[model samples]
Target: MKIIIILGIFLTSIANAGEHQIPTAPQKYLDMQNPIVKMDEQLLKITSRLYKRKCSKCHGKKGDGKGYHAENIEIKPAAFSIPDYMLNRKDGQLFWIMMNGSDDTEMVSVGPGTDIGLSEQQMWELITYLRKEFTK
Candidate 1:
């Protein structure tokens, strides 16, 4: 019984060691894909229009936090052009923020049933545009 338990522990340790080993070059290549080199112009136009209709009231036309309605609000909307703030956030995080606006800030969920009512795909497009435009 002692020998069996020792062998089991030894085998488990070996398996774990192998699992943590650095992956091969081919494996790394398969893990990642090339990023989209260019934005789709048609999608850009659609998202731009959506931004104008929904976001321009708070984020401004250029996403610089200078929208016409911004003066009345206590908390200023995020300036999307700021590289420091834009770089740390992931696309998924941005999507979540758009779908469920920050609790402390004036930003509200622009998703369905809300005043702005943006679809999931539309929010994704807006995220893509913001990431592309803001992140260097």
Candidate 2:
């Protein structure tokens, strides 16, 4: 009886191990071509500074959407790391949001000469930086 129980346990363990095997990474997917160009140091600096000055208030320091003032806002800030949320928003939509702001939330327009000021170029750069950094 003891040997039978031990053998059963051993077989179950082996079966479970085989069933729960980790999936291997696909080399073909990893080797797929992408057209994104790397940003220069100056561009990176501008992105970092812009994020610090304007975005850090609500989007957080690392763009994790947990800024200092986030708690006080009625709606929680969007998490950049979320692929579903990021995928739904297009570059044009994001640009419009940056320029015109959302009426539903605390987000406000940061267009040229506005209180939360940002030029069109700056907003576009910000959009580029965010898309590159967050999207998979």
Candidate 3:
């Protein structure tokens, strides 16, 4: 049993060894800026809940991408807690992923028209929250 567990962990590590291959956002999205300039208490409260509900299952509460569903998914969720990872990604890139999702991964569209129904402002707020709370 111990061997099995160790092997599972090893395989998981191997799976996550490579850098993520997220596509670039369009020029328009790349040029966009985050409108939310602040991370007040109220915003944190709201965005935390949003993250817990929609993201924690895969991204982990600590933004480590080893949440409940991470083991089952083919592609791992982004690990925002990694040093300099979040800082390197542009705000618009994050926003585009939240809105349109990735084609190669299971991440589905969560924009306004989708079932998740996240508005543009809400996505931006989540981006702000992620940058503030997860970036190492």
Highest lDDT: give the candidate number.
3
Give one digit per residue, the lDDT tens place, for model 1 in 1-136.
9999999999998787455422223343334332433557887887778788888888888778789999988667778876576776555566666767776567788887888888776777787777666555
Give per-candidate clash totals: 0, 0, 0
Candidate 2's C-alpha runs over 4 A off are 1-38
Give the CA lDDT, 0 to 100, for residue 89 in model 2: 62
CA error at residue 107 for candidate 1, angstroms: 0.9
lDDT tens readout by residue for model 3, 1-136: 9999999999887877565578899989989989998978987999999999999999999999989999998778889999999989999999998888998797888989999999999999998898899999
Which digits, one per residue and each the tens of the lDDT, describe model 2 over residues 24-107? Answer: 224543343323245777997888788888887788876778889998986666667675666766666666667666665777
Ranking by TM-score: 3, 2, 1
**Which wins on lDDT, candidate 2 or candidate 3?**
3
Give per-model TM-scores.
0.65, 0.66, 0.84
Error of 3 at 17 (Å): 10
Q: Which ranges in model 1 have alpha carbons more than 4 Å from their true place?
A: 1-39
